[model samples]
Target: MARTTGSHSDITGPRVRAAALSLFAQHGFAAVSMRQIAREVGVQAGALYNYTPDKQSLLFDLMQTHMSDLLSSRDKLPETASPLEALETFTRFHIRFHSERPEEVFIAYMELRNLEPENFEAIEKLRRTYEDQLENILRAGVSEGVFKVADPKLATMAVIAMLTGVNTWFREGGRLSLEEVEQIYWDMVRKSVGA
Candidate 1:
């Protein structure tokens, strides 16, 4: 396809992804059509092909982008920091990050079964990388005798599940602020690990 000077992929690409993310979050991956996504982007359906080849590719891209952003934005816990400090950082960061992108987070979990095998593998790999960050923190904390976790791997899964569960029920003005929620989760995470 010939490139048009005004129809830039840089601008349209993200819009396409965002539209797809919202649609897939609102309707299951099986239910959302490329034309609906194109409408959401205010472009013709054919224009969507300029950004993604097909719906499967678009879903994979959304998931890949979500996981990539997750890995990139994760806190870089310093070696000098204590296990408790590292854990608190991870806990708070996890809650806040997931909360900020409820749609992406929702699709990330809800649409996993929709991914092709290769795409599923790629997303799972990125998920493991994110999980490993906390696992290492837990291991370090245990080694330092600051945490009494029975299994770092299991604890990593538990902490992530507990933190992510917040997005399902949390609202900005209903009861507590996100900061307050983070504090409460931090306390629970700390005690769960016996910090």
Candidate 2:
């Protein structure tokens, strides 16, 4: 099919993904269809093929982009002098980052079962890399005799699960501000690792 008049891939491509993300987050991957995404994007159903080969590919791309942005943002955080400081930074960062993108977080966690085997592996690798950052911090603290974690790996997962759990209950103007929530979580995390 010929390209739609006045349509640009640069602009429409992101709209397509955004629409898919929103729909997937709202209705789930198995329930959502490319035609629905195209309608949400204000394009014809067939137009979506210009951007993604299939719904599975679109889902994979959304997940991949989320993980990539997460890693990139995390890598930019300034280095800290001690494992204690690093752990604090990571605890706050994870809460802040995941909370801000609730839809992406929801889809990333909820839609994993829908991913194809290879895509699932790829996303899992990225998640492990992020988790490894926290694990390494726990390891460093253990080596320095600051953190009393019995198992750095277990502590990493626990801390991350605790931090990410904030998103499920957090709202912008609720009982606690995000900063306050961050501080509360930081304190819990510090004690969890015996820092």
Candidate 3:
């Protein structure tokens, strides 16, 4: 079983989660089985049950972990940062993080439909938390006259959609470095808000 404490267990959970995330991303949740995930993780099929009770639980766990990591990482940013700084911080962090964990991003976005109704609601709540963070930054920028967006919520969704779309075409040897990509996105986002 994957324990909650210790470095060893910590590593195991992420490894299992990553394997599951990649599989789910490549094949929709309904098409993936515990055996498939175990094969990817190099464990016996039955051993997969040690980490999660069932397939739905595994999907929920993956989404929960991804959401929690995102929120926790965002929460670590400097609290007193300006609105523009906050948005930039979030944008840069998101771009870099998603680049490093494309499978998780894919699973988070695509496999949401596989969740049971209760699980879906819980995941949606966590998702809204992340969205609210972006909205908060946008609202702050509008309040301080640094940004001129008419609707912070709509603006937040637009920026997130544009930023997340990078995962679709981004390649390791692409012409643009991650920093350059982030800068391009930052420019577009800033201009979109009338910064």
Q: How high is the CA lDDT of each candidate model?
A: 0.91, 0.92, 0.85
Q: What is the lDDT of residue 112 in candidate 3?
A: 80
Candidate 3 RMSD computed on C-alpha atoms after optimal superposition onto the true structure: 3.2
- Candidate 1 lDDT, 1-195, residue by residue in tens: 677746688889889988888889888899999999999999999988988899999999888988999889978766688878888988998998999999999899998999999999999999999999899989988998999999999999999999999998999997899999999999999999997
Residue pairs in candidate 2 whose N, alpha carbon or C atoms collide under 3 angstroms: none
With a 3 Å backbone cut-off (N, CA, C), the pairs that clash in candidate 1 are none
Cα TM-score per model: 0.94, 0.94, 0.88
Question: In model 3, where do residues sit more than 4 Å from their true spots?
Answer: 1-15, 75-79
In the range 118-146, model 3's lDDT, one tens digit per residue, is 99999999989999999999999999999
1 or 3, which is superior by lDDT?
Answer: 1
In model 1, the runs with Cα more than 4 Å from the true position are 1-7
Structure candidate 3, residue pairs in collision: none
**Ranking 1 against 2 by lDDT, winner:** 2
The ten-residue window of minimal lDDT in model 2 covers 73-82
